[model samples]
Target chain A: MITPITETDLLLFYYQEADEVTTSIIREHLPENTDWQYFLNELATISSESSSLMCSPSNTTLSIILEESRSQLEHTL
Target chain B: MNAPIIADGVLIQRYMQGNQAAFETLLNRHRNRIFTSIYLLVNDRYLAEDIFQETFIKIINNIQAGKYNHEDKFLPWAMRIARNLSIDTIRSRKRMPVVVDSEGRDVFDCLGISVQSREDEQINQDEISALKHWIRELPEEQREVLILRNYAELSFKEIAVLTNTNINTCIGRMHYAILNLRKKMQKNTVRVK
Candidate 1:
């Protein structure tokens, strides 16, 4: 009997957190399931697009952090 | 030949042993993701910077004090500290974060876009701003799950632990967050058309 897939399963599968058996099941099921295929594609597109939305903190903040670390080292010495 | 890339655990060991450069390498490597994660949670640039600084300071202190124990899983461990600090600041302020600054700039305005023609850049910027705005509009729980999963690069299991929810719940929230985002994007596209 075929196991029914949940949206949670699809999500885990997309994130590569699914077990090997579930991964195989999803891989086998995707070819025969257009809806799941579309969902997976949407998940992939969202992941790809959102991954680029990184922003850096200001230089001053970084400088301060490094200075704090240096001070800590001095205290330890 | 290229030098072998050192793992985070090794870098932590070096930093703990008085090698500041190792800590610098670690900071430079994960700075963007850590900053962005805090910014998204707080939705204020200045506040985000403050929290980011605090997060790293706490990390340094923890490492020096021998409180850092998560081996090789540095980003997620740092992210948990960042997340907690952001949440504490938000709760203390007793207000939800706004999507735009006082001058009406987008919270994501600091994100770097690829170089392109002015017109194309404008279009791309507008689209990214809209996407980020939609993300900011999501329910707090859903947005938290999405940010932790995507920006922090935490596994669902880690997210579940961080958020104090079960793994299935984390996965479910992520699924709904993606679906909600897609629906909002589709609706916006229809309106634009």
Candidate 2:
């Protein structure tokens, strides 16, 4: 019987975090063709959007400043 | 603004030694990632921009004053500052009770993203939008884990370090996130048919 993959199991696979046995099980049980396609698509879509959200403009500026400040400080000290 | 791409550690060493150009290089390399991190937390582009600028200023001031430390962990440390500030801004709002509700709403509403990827054309726009929207509704813990693990391509150990969480908890959160997303997608697919 081709058991449906659980979210937990799928997550481990998607992240390449699962052990070989579990990974093999997931690969074997994965939905075929369009089913897997849409599944992968959905995961990518959400993850990308959330990543875009999490990294803020302020964070970028801070990175810039940190880089510059540290460099400048290194030179001075 | 314009500097060579030196390693972060090297840049930190240079900064500590008073190399201004080295500091700028580090900032340029990481600005976008850092900005996005802050933007996610606050969900306000304008406020995020302000905070982003402020974070740099604070860092620069600290460095000049010889107060900056944690050489290797600088980026994460700065991120910690940005996160704290963004959270503080949310708390200080007049409608503080409603902030969480509204932040989630705003993020969810924007789930319909127009991806500019080459393969995007192959995907149905509505379906893509729906999928993205559903992911947005996931719990913050799950969402963060998903982003770190997938989007940022951070390993569980790396994510654990970044979020100050354990590997098991990180994996668990990611599991729940995927599970919720899968359930939502299944429901949506059924509704469409």
Candidate 1 stretches greater than 4 Å from native: B70-72, B95-128, B190-193
The residue-by-residue lDDT of candidate 2 on A1-77, one tens digit each, is 65556655566666677778878876665655466656666666556545543332444545565556656555556
Candidate 2 lDDT, tens digit per residue, B125-164? Answer: 3234454445557787887766555544567877787788
Residues B84-173 of candidate 1: C-alpha lDDT, one tens digit per residue? 999999898676454676779655454442122333454454444666667788999999999998888889888888899998888878
In model 2 chain B, the worst 10-residue window by lDDT is B113-122
> TM-score of each candidate?
0.83, 0.59
lDDT of each: 0.83, 0.62
